[model samples]
Target chain A: MGILGVILAVTNLVVVVCMHISFRQYGKYKEHMILGVTLSEEQVKDDEIQCLLEKYRKSFRKYIIIGYITGILVIIPFEWYVSIALILYLVWMFGYIFLIQHIYVKYHKKLYAIKKQKGYTYGKIVNEITIDTKLSYAKDKMPVSPGWFLPSMLVFLIPLSNKGVREFILSNLQMSCVFIGVIVLVKASYLLIYYMFAKQRSQVYSGNSDINIACNRVTKRGYSIVFVVASFFDSISFFMLLWDEIAMGSMTMVGVLLFVVMQCIIVMGMVVGLIQIKKKRESILAEDSQERVVDEDEFWATGFYRNPMDNRLLVPDRQSDMNMTLNMAKPSAWIWTAGIGIGTAVLLLWTSVVMLRLDFVPVTYQVADKFEIIAPSYSKTIEFDEIQWVTLLDEFPDIKASKQNGAATDEYALGRFHIRNEGTCYLYIYHGYSPVLELQLNDMKIYCNSREDGVIQECYQQLQEKLSE
Target chain B: MIFHLNMSSETPIYVQLRNQIVLGIGRGDLLPGEALPTVRQLAEDIGVNNMTVNKAYQILKSEGYIEIDRRHGAKVAKHQKDDKEFEVYLKDKMELAAAEAKAHGIELTQFMDYCREAFGVNEEA
Candidate 1:
């Protein structure tokens, strides 16, 4: 629990720091835009505007200090209850996100107000979009072919080649499906993002077709390469699931943590790629001496691109992801927004509830017609006919085993485990408790005990009586 | 040359596109025989309806500023021919603009200078 708490603390700190830095970046000019408002090159140098930008930076930094302090105070102390600590940590993350977004919008509006006062975009063709006709005529080549996805898909399927993985998956089809389904969905969404980026209006930087082509080519290629590289990261988790079933140990948790680390690595790679591409585009922009810069600030007055003129369903967000935002003018955009909103809510709720259950629900047993042992999400029932023997041991079996699935913590292990001498068994045991009841079934063994010592003894006695009759 | 378009502008989108192209040509930014993007491509890039671009191309073609070929798409014409209909329309449009300029307290000399500047002429010239 302490180790997990420390890891969670580190993750929280990283997220908070990243959020602090990334949100601050929006205040600077990029692609001729600053704080979601477009500005003239001359206006960008204005003293009063610079002061406001300084305030924008300082304001977020001040808020971040408080957020960081609060996160440390809330997440670090409650390390004993890992579930509670995790929930608090998530809440802190959500709170920090809300805080940053709120601060960003507040400053975005302020910058826009200053822009209005300066008449930067006023009495002007602020909705100007520079398109290099020649470049447009020779349509941009982006979006990695669907064929590129086959290698990652093959890696995902590689686990099926192993006999243990196949049997494990076959026996627990639903659980495995849900797990695999999540990974597949993530990959599918990324592919969708890639397609949207391809379909998106290419960034037309200058009248010079060559400059425009160079800028857009690097941007698109950078995005394509980043997604392609990250596409293979998920395949590692597949082998992680089956590593323990063959070589017996707590490899599942290690695998999950490794997967997380890989995810972080991919995100860092994307950031690096973005930085390099931006530098390249900025360098090439110097060549095209006379280029029209767009200032569609009115459309993005709310800090989101809401252009009715832009026919594309998705647009590259000025923030983190390339295709994270919707073109609000499209009616279908509302459906997409609602879907995202609902999906996020469902995932958050499901995770919180699952975590809470793992910490609170005690191991339980009922022996009526069938011997049912249940704990949180991991539960199993053994039929009376299948049970060949039942024994109530005074001492807990100190057997070497590994968890196949379920919650494992310092307190208990409640799930499927493969015992070294006993083969596969459904275990519902608490470390603090003892004298567990063991049942021998046709193909598998069951070891479970209740929190109440008397209740466990009663269950064992009743099972024995029922079996004799 | 980059075409600056504003959806909320008083001028129609197609007219904005047409004016930019004409300016590019007069400024020599768009050279004679230089190819233009096809209607579909331009429309897609600018995120406008295809008809808007088609209208601009048709106007440019009718005024003898460009030639549209099935294979080569639209290309800037080597020579801009004088058309009676265009002269008449230009006269009417210029008269209205001059009237608007007068209302805005612009002198005839200033208006002439602005017009000359529009034609890419220096004050000394």
Candidate 2:
């Protein structure tokens, strides 16, 4: 099941990636930048920036395709080796994204300021091009590279470092096992510290003009410590691994698995984050170029585009941009929230299957069966307004009267009322039953279990993107 | 000697360079018609963007502190011959000196004594 699950995950990722590439290529071919942006067309006179961006984007697409193809190609012949290679490749790309971007972004503005002082006319052009390539690199953070160094390095050193001693220590079996445990704890803490710093940084950036970002300075000390501490733990693990009889354990195996999975998630989170930073920088540059001079608030206002001609505002109807920004701002928040939601649903689904296998719960409930059942759509809808809740309760009263799941009622002084009706129910209606042991006539496919769960996931993803912005 | 600039100072490099050039003229460190550094050379020497040095040179030219020729680099302007302009310059210098002494908490009598000493005039009699 785990193998199948991994296969399915890879397949889904491939499909999503292909879709993204096609969409971007189509966008490029069409020469279609995003709409509702208020940038003056003249600000992009040279299109050197756009051309540079497109070049990187094309390369990114090619690499992504090649990486996936290689993963599949290699895996068919050599499963374990290829799997490890693919994981390592992804890890390397992720680290490359972070480190390279930090360097580029840190130096970009200073370089531009120098250019401006030299009477170089196209400061905006250089800045925009810098931003776009960074974005492209970020999106392609997981493209496979040649496998010789990737897995070997990941096994020994963390993805970002290539120090010989560190590599030796990391790959040591006993040290690696201990390092695995340390990594899990460090990563979990990293997520928290990253969240706090990101939130604080965003607030500071979004606040006032006098508060310059100091151009890629280490704004968050705690997050830096977390990263450093993780590396330190890796060093300790390397030393520990030097000892025999320490590397082989059920706990060690679990820790290694957990570390790999968490790292993968972190890579995904960072990709999402970089995309967001790219988006923010793009919009900010566009806005900056359009305006002759900007005050503080103008710097912070990024969502809507202003018309250069009539000075009319064009706001996007969709909330996708907001979601994208939020996700970029605090990807771990989105990851954790979405993970919890999806995890719970998946767990419940599995538990249901398990109960049937163990004869703990009946395969099907009869109409008269008086077992407590949870109604779908209980969690998704906003419970803020009393009237909305009342209306929901009025629509379905049977589940409302039950004591389980705490169907709370709220009526505001303004005469609005909300009553939760789906949290508790005494009876469930089942139309048919299928025996598990017998061969099923048609495959039992899962549909949307509940709109609330589905919507929450979407909202979480959207919120993640929004916060990143 | 032509004035030189220190670029790495937190103060605007151009302002520092400009002040130094002005002081060079006032202190006779730069003689009349002395050749100054070319904008490019000055920029390189100070480790500043060329535009900053150019801006300072432009200001110096406008103030008649220096002049530039197509073939030659910037040069200090010849010493002023107009009596009215020289009188105004001397008054401005004296005012500036008085302000400096006041800033240093020196009394008017001490300031006069310092001025007399600078002029080699003894007040013993």
Candidate 3:
């Protein structure tokens, strides 16, 4: 498979596997919650509920297997539909999240119907808040102090550690500052989430206050430890980018590898933590034998926690333990959601614009008072006196270079690319076409080329005439 | 004592909170001089406005059911015999309840039995 095909296939596999595992988790009862719905002890043992779950299991398995195969088929159009593959995959991935939710919700509705038919809902929808007063004190300790996060901020020191990265950062201090600032912001955001979890209500899982306190301790520690440790893990991704600044073009993809790895590991760690807390809570309750849980079903009857009566800004997601969703009851939640949505749209729009331009826009040379090369997005002018020499390159060289900035596809390369030995080159070329015109300047090289016959030769003559004058 | 609050009750949040605490004290679930969660702590736990919890604590303090001081924060007050103020409050509540019971054709003995059931259930615990 080509790079696009490889990306599509791998992403498809990961999504399918993850969904398979998480989707199955909804089949079992966790804290008396199933498919975002809460149940009572007696309802859990009912024959109709068991039968409904069995029915859902069969259909869910069949749908998932079919979905995986359909996703795999996305690779078929890789070579022929190269330009659209990324956009296609992105659209598919977006829909995939929703489609899975749709399937889950379908079963949720059926279960709801059965619940109403059998009068299984034990109580009215109410904003019920449960708290162990002793465990809910403000002076309660965190798993680790804020000082633990100081180490995560050490991501700034990474570029200075490596010689090549140090030189790169020194050369462009502004870019380095931006990179460090982003890393700090991400770490700070994680810390904020940890703060929210720390301030969360202490659930009273049993009548014995000590047992309830222990359950809260384990749950808080599980989530808190993961967030703190995960923040430190991010430093590795920053180190990868620093290395990418120096590594050859072939190894440039190493930058993205650590970042993707960090994301996958942190997400998996959080899931593991969730499972650990759930199991431990169950075992502790078993020993205590005085199980108690509040019915906050009204707030969580839907996929979201939306209780205007409750003033919390964030709450645990009912459907998945992997996320802490904004409490829709708060105005700040709407603002945050809108902000994230707009930011994502703007980012996607910028990327799609660049990709489309790189693929479809042809580069053209205009011979005038000064030589100008124009691509759709930008144009560059070179004075006749600036060009020291112009030569027709019979074939493009096999020199390796790292892309500092700009966008690229298989057929074209544009913008600034850093060559290991040659310093820097401004590229405006159809790399596959020849003869290429290499315009040499005092301190840099500008490469220009086209697909049509004699275009480079004609441009070369015009540049020579201007230079001869 | 653990607080179980219902936001959907026709009663206001502060009233519900105040009632729960009073009941906890009556049932000996909240022992005399036991330290209660601070207003902010209770508010955070219930995801309610801080003032709502503060109002509940203030009412408890005024009624002599709890004491709020800087050092001890809000703690259950020492046990006290019912006073004239409490008796008047009780009479008003009982009059309304008794009128409703009379409307439902409940005898005085049956009403006394209901009161015993209400008071005895928690004492059994």
Candidate 4:
């Protein structure tokens, strides 16, 4: 296999390894870490929780072993399709994880019910731990400042100031700045809002209040650091795209590699941070004597959280304090759920449509007082009066361009592209199909060709006849 | 003022919001001409639909409990002297309450006492 295939295989292997690690860590945390209860108290009520954890762990371990073994076995013979194998593995892993989580949740709910019935109290020694308001609401302890992301806008200026860069942005970097800007804005908003509202102490537990606050502060700082690091990586990526050498040829393979590495580092960083925070919190809890464990029975189910009793829509996820989960009872939650469901369905449908169009759709051109070009994703009609000039070219123009819409492959170019010299042009030319007809319209250009050379000639003759008339 | 909405209640959210605002006004918790949270802000905070909050605001506006401006969103309306129309409306509502109380076997005096307590008015001579 080629270098690309080898790289892909290695990446796939790394991803599988990461997934295994993450799942194992999550399972470990779920099994051992009782959120409110002390270790001694947890042991007292551990019958069902222990049974559930054992069952889940056994199944989880079995699945991972089978999955990895199968993946390795498949990769041995069909290494070229390593990426596909990795995807299948991922699907299997996620499906199993979901099933296990569901089972765990079911068992947990039953256990919680039993505990409630038996009058099992968690950390009932109420000790009022007075927390300094400054510690609770410290600005420095907040997550990444939104201001750190504003520098990303400098990418726009890089293109605007230089002529070569302007052409690159208009053609190569078309709307990428807009996309990146939107992402930065969204991340900034989410971080800012989450820090401002969601990070507030919901229920201050006894003895561990200081520890809880400290944990939150540390986690927030970690998230901020992660965000800053991610933003820095994004800036690097944006700059990488500006390199003309990288923009051309198989350098995109290198870019993909860099992206994969960045993702791995980020994921590892987050996991380590989470594990560290959890360890610290557990240590603090172990040392503390006075603990107040509220009955969190109605609040969480399995891993999923939904409290009909709680009025708030966005609640902190039980598994991860950093993330938010919908309170399913809320009207807004239902709306958001429906919206996401519909959005996913629509995306799947659109993707299917695009695939079908790409495979089956043919380019068609006609002249009836006006010149019109039609393809699956690219379609345009040019007024006869607006036609500036028409020329037949034997070779494809070596124009630097970026696709605005439609497909541009080695075999054919069927898209709206912002060409360096030609401006915005609709291309419907097969690379092998010689003698392409070029139309220079009032404000834009059109390149047209057909699979059959005779058809192109016929279209050219017809266009000439119409122009003469 | 913090509004507590019972999601499980048979009463609609808009009606609950309207009732709460009216109760707040009656309890002197919400002063006349006091600015209320904008419909969007209230809806987001409560995690309800914007239209639900808007509907509540509309009800308040029609009842002269709040006035809505394009720039300022919604605010409590300035207190006006009790008019004959308001007295008629109040009488109509009180009659309905009296009928309900009678159906429930509540005496007229007890119902009046309950109303007086709710209104925070002095016991009659």
DockQ, all models: 0.42, 0.01, 0.52, 0.03
TM-score of chain A of each: 0.85, 0.27, 0.88, 0.73
User: Would you list the clashing residue pairs of candidate 1?
Assistant: none
Best by DockQ, which number?
3
Model 3, A148-217: lDDT tens per residue? 7777777666556778767766654555576678877888798888887777766667778888778777
Which wins on DockQ, candidate 1 or candidate 3? 3
lDDT of 1 by residue, A1-469 (tens): 4446545665766677667667767777776777777776678889988998899889888888887787677765454565777778777888788878888888888888888786666223444566666677655455556577667667767777878767766665555676678878878877876766665676776657787777777777777777777776655544554464445543555655665566666666677777777778778886679565655677778877788766677677865445368888788999988998799879988998988888887767788888777678987777899999989887668786666676666667778776654567787877768678888899988878767859888998899899999
lDDT per residue, candidate 4, A107-128, as tens digits? 4565555566666654333212
Order the candidates by TM-score, highest first: 3, 1, 4, 2
Query: How well is each residue in B13-47 modelled by candidate 2, as lDDT tens digits?
Result: 67777777777777676678877766754543343
Off by over 4 Å in 2: A1-59, A76-120, A124-248, A251-256, A277-469, B1-125
RMSD of 4: 10.8
What overall lDDT goes with each candidate model?
Answer: 0.75, 0.38, 0.75, 0.62
User: What is the iRMSD of the candidate numbered 2?
Assistant: 20.5
Please identify model 3 stretches exceeding 4 Å from their true place: A1-9, A39-51, A70-82, A122-127, A155-164, A247-251, A293-308, A326-350, A383-389, A397-399, A420-424, A441-443, B59-73, B77-125
Q: Which stretches of model 1 miss by more than 4 angstroms?
A: A2-7, A29-32, A40-51, A66-78, A118-124, A128-130, A142-151, A154-180, A233-254, A319-323, A329-335, A368-383, A394-405, A415-424, B4-44, B48-125
Please state the Cα-based DockQ of model 3 relative to the true two-chain complex: 0.52
Better of 1 and 4 by lDDT: 1
| Per-model TM-score versus the true fold | 0.76, 0.26, 0.84, 0.62
RMSD to the true structure for each prediction, in A, is 5.6, 27.2, 4.2, 10.8
